[model samples]
Target: MSGEFGEEEQIEEQEGPAPSLAQIKHIILILSGKGGVGKSSVTTQAALTLCNMGYKVGVLDIDLTGPSLPRMFGLENRSIYQAAEGWLPVPVETNGVGSLSVISLGFLLGDRGNSVVWRGPKKTAMIKQFIKDVAWGQLDYLLIDTPPGTSDEHISIAEQLRFSEPDGAIVVTTPQSVATADVKKELNFCKKVALHILGVVENMSGFICPHCEECTNIFSSGGGLKLAEEFNVPYLGNVPIDPKFVELIENQTTADESLVESYGKSTLCPIFKDIMDKVLAQNRPARC
Candidate 1:
C-alpha cells in the first residue's frame, strides 16, 4: 500500500496543475505614491469594514521591506506555517465582525529590522510565491497592501494578478497638495498596469479637537476630493486624525464592539462606512 501510494503521489505531483482562479473572487491592491500617508491603516480598516459587513476577506502584505499589516491586525506574534501543501495564513478575528486571513513578510523573517535587500526580479519572485503558495481559500476580497511608490513589488502584483485585473485599487493619501500630487503618478502606474482605479481615500484630512469638538485643517483640506474629481474617480472619503485611533492601533485592538460604541458617532466611522458602501457597490458585479 505504501509503495502504491508513493507512486500515485509522484504521478499526481507531475501531472497536477496549480490552483484555479475560481477559488478567488477579487484582488484589490491598496497603494500610495509616498509613505507616511496612512495607506496601511486604510487597507486594514477596509478589510475590517468588509469583514464587518459579512464578507470573507484576506490581506496580503506585499511590502516585504516594511511589512505592517501583521502589526496593524495585531498578529505580529503569529506566524505562517509551511506544510506539505503550502503556507497557511493566520486568521485574525474582529469582535462582533467576521474574520480575516493575513499573510506578511513579518511572519517569515525572525528579525523585524532586517531589510529586504533584493533586486526587482527577486522581489517579484517572492511576491509570486506569496500569491501562489499561500492558501487563501475562498475570499470575497483579497486586499494586497503594497509598499508605497511604484516599485518592483507593485509591478509584480499588477502583472501577476492581471488575469484577475482586480476589481480596482484604493489609493490612500493625505489632504496636502504634495501627497495628492504624487497620487496622480500612482494612478498612472495603475493605468499602465491595466488596473482600474476604485477611488482615493484622504487620510488625516483634518484634526478633530477632542476637547473642543472643533475641526482644524492640519494638512489642508479638499485636495484628495479635488484630485478624485479631476481624475473622474469616485471620492471614497476622509479619515480624520483621531488620537484614539492611534491608541487603538498601537494597542492592537481589533474589536469593532468597543470602537463602535466609542467613536461610532464620530465622522471617522461614518466616513469609513461610506467607503465600505462604495467598495461594496463596486464589488457587486465582480461578486456576481
Candidate 2:
C-alpha cells in the first residue's frame, strides 16, 4: 500500500505546476499529416466558430517553426504582455466577440521572415512552458495547432498531457493521396498514444469559383471520408475554398467588418460549422 501510495505521489510531482489545466474544460489538438493543407486556417476558423457558439476558446499555436496564428487572427504586430499570473495570451476578437485568447511563437519572432531553428529538447521545453506558464484562465476549449507531421512535438504533447488526457485530436488533410497517406500515419500515432480521435476534417475539400459559383475539384475530393471509413472514425465535415477567406487572413486584420461579413457568408464557414456540429453532437461530454 505504501509503495502504491508513493507512486501516486511521484506522479503528482511529475505533473509539476499547472499539471492539469483545471480552468480549461476540454483540450483538443488539430494536427495534419503535412503542412500547406490549410491546417492553420482550419484551426483558426474552428476556434472562431466555437466562439460564435458562445464558448470561451483559446488557441495555442504549437507550430513553433511556422507559427501563423498571429497573422491568421489578424494579430500581427501584437506582443505578449506579462501579467501577475503568467504570460498573457493575445486575445482574438471574432465578430466583435473576443471570446478567444491565442498564443504563438510567431508573436515572439523578431521579424516576419525570421526562422525558428531549435533542436528537439529546446522545442519540447518551449511546449512544456506553454502548457505550464501561460495564464489560460477559465476556458471552454483550448485548441492546439500542432506542427505538420508527427515527430518530437507530437510525442511531447501526448506524454505531457497523458494525465490531462486531452479530449481528442482532429486530423486535417486534403483530398489527395499524398496527404491522405500521411494522415494515416497521423491516425496511427494517435492510436499508439491512446488519444481519442474526435474526427477527421477535410479542408479545401472543393473550390467554388467566385464569379460563376461553380464547384471545381481542384484538389480532388473524398479522400478524407475514405480514410475516416478505413479507420472507423467519424467524418467531421469538409470546407470549400473561397477567395474572400483567403483575403481575410492574408490581410491580417478583422477590423474589416465587410470582409468579416463576406467571410462569414463564405462557403467554408457553414461547412466548418457542420463539422463542429458533428463534434458537438458526437462528443457532448467534450463540452463539459
Best by lDDT: 2
Which stretches of model 2 miss by more than 4 angstroms? 1-20, 94-98, 252-254, 258-265, 284-288
Clashing residue pairs found in predicted model 1: none
| Error of model 2, residue 200, in angstroms | 0.8
* TM-score of candidate 2 relative to the true fold: 0.89
* CA lDDT of every candidate: 0.77, 0.81
Error of 1 at 17 (Å): 12
Candidate 1, 13-105: lDDT as tens digits: 112223633466777888899798988888877776677677788888999888998788777767899877689889875555655889998
Runs off by more than 4 Å, candidate 1: 1-21, 253-267
How well does each candidate superpose onto the true structure, as a TM-score? 0.86, 0.89
> How many pairs of residues in model 1 come into backbone collision?
0
